[model samples]
Target: MSGIFLKQADFFETNGILFETGGFFLKQAEFFLKQAEFFMKQSDFSEESIVKK
Candidate 1:
C-alpha cells in the first residue's frame, strides 16, 4: 500500500516540475513576441516617415 502511494506521489511531483518548466518557457515566448512586435511597429513608423519626406 505504501509503495503504491509513493508511486502516485512521485508521478504528481514529476508532472508539477514539467508544468513549471512549461510555464517558464511560455512566459519567455510571450516576452519575445512582444519584443518582435515592438520592433516591427518601429520599423513601420520609420518607413512611413521616410516616404513622406
Candidate 2:
C-alpha cells in the first residue's frame, strides 16, 4: 500500500476491468462465430434440397 509507485489497489482494479473487457469481447466473438456456422449449415442444407428437387 505504501511506497507503491502506481498504487497497488488501482493497479488490481484496472487489471480486473481489463480482464472483464477481454472476456466480453471473446464471448462476442464466439457468438458471432456460432451464428456464422449456423448460417453456413443452413445454406448447405438448402443447396442439398435444391439439388434433390
Candidate 3:
C-alpha cells in the first residue's frame, strides 16, 4: 500500500515536470517565430526600398 502511494507520488512529480517543460518549449518556439517574422518584414522593406532607388 505504501509502495503504491510512493509510485503514484513519483508519477505525479514526473507529470508536473513534463508539463512545465512542454510549456517552456512552446514559449520558446513562439519567441523564435516572432523573431523570424520581424526579420522577414525588415528584409522585405529593404528590398522594396532598393527597388524604388
Candidate 4:
C-alpha cells in the first residue's frame, strides 16, 4: 500500500538525519581536541622560554 511505503520512507529519512547529526558532532569534537593539543604545546614552549630567560 502507498501508506506503508510512505511510513518506511519516513523512517529512513529520520535515520539519515540522526546519522548526519552524529557525524557532525564527531567532527566538531575532533577539531576541538586538535585545538587543545596545539594550545598545550604552545603553552609548554612559552614556559620553557621564560625559564631559559
Q: lDDT tens string, model 4, 1-53?
A: 33444444455556556787756555555555555566667778888999999
- Weakest ten-residue segment in model 1 by summed lDDT: 1-10
TM-score, candidate 2, is 0.61
Report the C-alpha lDDT of model 1 over 1-53, residue by residue, as the tens digit.
Answer: 23443444455556556777755555555555555566667778888999999
Clashing pairs in 2: none
Cα lDDT of candidate 4 equals 0.59
lDDT of 3 by residue, 1-53 (tens): 23444444455556557787756555555555555566667778888999999
Model 2 lDDT tens row, 1-53: 12242243344445556787656555555555555566667778888999999
User: How many angstroms is residue 28 displaced in model 3 relative to the true structure, after the best TM-score fit?
Assistant: 0.5
Task: Give residue 3's lDDT in candidate 3 (0 to 100).
Answer: 41
Colliding pairs, model 1: none
- C-alpha lDDT score of every prediction, in listed order: 0.59, 0.57, 0.59, 0.59
Off by over 4 Å in 2: 1-20
For candidate 3, give the lDDT. 0.59
What would the TM-scores of all predictions be?
0.61, 0.61, 0.61, 0.61
Candidate 1 global CA lDDT score: 0.59
Per-residue lDDT for 30 in model 4?
52
